[model samples]
Target: MNAVGVDVGGTKIAAGVVTPEGKILDEVRYPTPHSPGTLVETIARAITEVGDAPEVGGVCLAVPGLVLAQENKVVYSPNLRAVEGIPLKDELEPKIGMPLTVENDGNAAAWGEFRFGVGSEADHLVFVTLGTGIGGGVITHGILMRGAQGSGGELGHVTIQATGPRCACGNHGCLEALASGTAIGRRARELAVEHPDSALGRLAARRQILGEDVTELAREGDEVALSVLDEAGRWLGVGLAGFINIFNPEVVAVGGGVMEAEELVLEAARKEVILRARPPSRDLADVKVATLGPKSGVLGAAALARDASSREYLLGG
Candidate 1:
């Protein structure tokens, strides 16, 4: 069966019709509006634009927020506050002419990887995206492990250092505060000030140091930039090691913009995983890059939509 998935972000909205095999049939994109009404209208329009599949069973919205999946609502979204507290299913179903569901963008993306990307062969998988903030999901025994309120698998918020940097979520020492793109930038700026003679320091003196800039400087053989990435990666691995012990996933797939640094960061993370993660689990878990990249949200949400439809039909039958 075909389904439609909408990946709604702070900047843009991407909607696509997808088949069971994970091919996108039709797709549309729109700049996301900040107001509640316009956000709803934009999402509805995007869905309608791409939902022409003759047998689209359902639609799922991949939203960046604390989603109440049972209610098909987003309770809170830090980056895209426009989506919060909205009756998404009630509003979207009427406009798009189909049943709709909602999910955390991270969870939806993890499902996409499990279904079609790196975790295709694994029954247990852990997927994390390192962007402005860290977000992640877990699939264990072929099941997406949403907690009691459908807010589980929040890997980014896990605390690594008790007295470390503050997170946007108001926590101290969260993995997001140490290993995300935002964290990388913040750390790079600090390092640039400390080492004002290096290439990173030279650039930071001229303009604000962004995460991509750190990666570029590292590629050009700047020791200071390389150190910043290594620090973040080690922090990430510290968090991942705990997850490895708890979930024992066969694969740990990392994605998002920060991954552009690739091995520059992952190499350090792998070393920490080896040092901290217990034997057998550490040896068994394969830390690698996610293949779906940015499209994971749309594809995963579509797959979840199909899964939801199948369940409903079976129940009705």
Candidate 2:
């Protein structure tokens, strides 16, 4: 049976009806609403629009927040604050007329990669997305490791440097604070002030330096811009090395806007991993770019919905 996956992002919500084989049969996108009532309605609309087929069995929402899996609710989401404290399953299930569940967006993306993307060939995988913030999830022994509170795979919050910049989560020296796209932009702006004649500096003089601008400048061989990415990549590597030691995943898949720089960023991260990560696990992990890109959350959530449907059938039988 097919299932519906809803990716509730900060700016928009995307829902897709996906087959067991991972093909998206139908999809819809809607701008995310900020109000609690409108947010629930928007999500319900997206699901119903995409999941018209009777073959679609269930649904899972991939949301940006600290989700309570058992309760199927979002407890906190800094990026999409309107989703906070909403009992999503309770609100959405009735509207969409299906069994629904909620998952952290990062976990959903990790599952997507494991099931259909770069990590499809690996039983153990680590997934990290470097966007406005750093989000990550882990699949070890073929299962997601959600902690007691359903916040287990929060890789970005780990402190790699005790004295680094502050993160959105208010933590200092967090991997997110150093390696996220937001961090890249912040770093780029800071460096532009030091090298006013550089391309990045010239651009920043006109307007704020975004993460994409940094990548563009680096591609043009701007030294200051390249250095900013190099620093962020090294910090990312520091975080990945710790994950390598703990989970020992076979593949570490990196995704998100920052990764558009590709080798410009990952080359440095790999070098750091080689230096810091220990023997077997370090040597075994293949750090690669995620294949699904922006669609991972939707695909992964659909997979989770399929899993939930199977579990329900077994429980009922």
True-structure RMSD, every candidate:
2.1, 2.2
Q: Write the per-residue lDDT of candidate 1 for residues 151-248, one digit (tens) a residue.
A: 88899999999999999999999999999999999999999999999999899889999999999999999999999999999999999999999999
Q: Candidate 2, clashing residue pairs?
A: none
- For 12-33, candidate 2 gives per-residue lDDT tens digits of 9999999988999889999999
Clashing pairs in 1: none
Go through the candidates in order and give the clash count of each. Answer: 0, 0
lDDT of 2 at 265: 94
- Which lDDT values do the candidates have, in the order given? 0.93, 0.92
TM-score, candidate 2, is 0.97
Q: Model 1, residue 107: displacement in angstroms?
A: 0.3
> Any runs in candidate 1 off by more than 4 Å, and if so which?
311-317
lDDT: which candidate is best?
Answer: 1
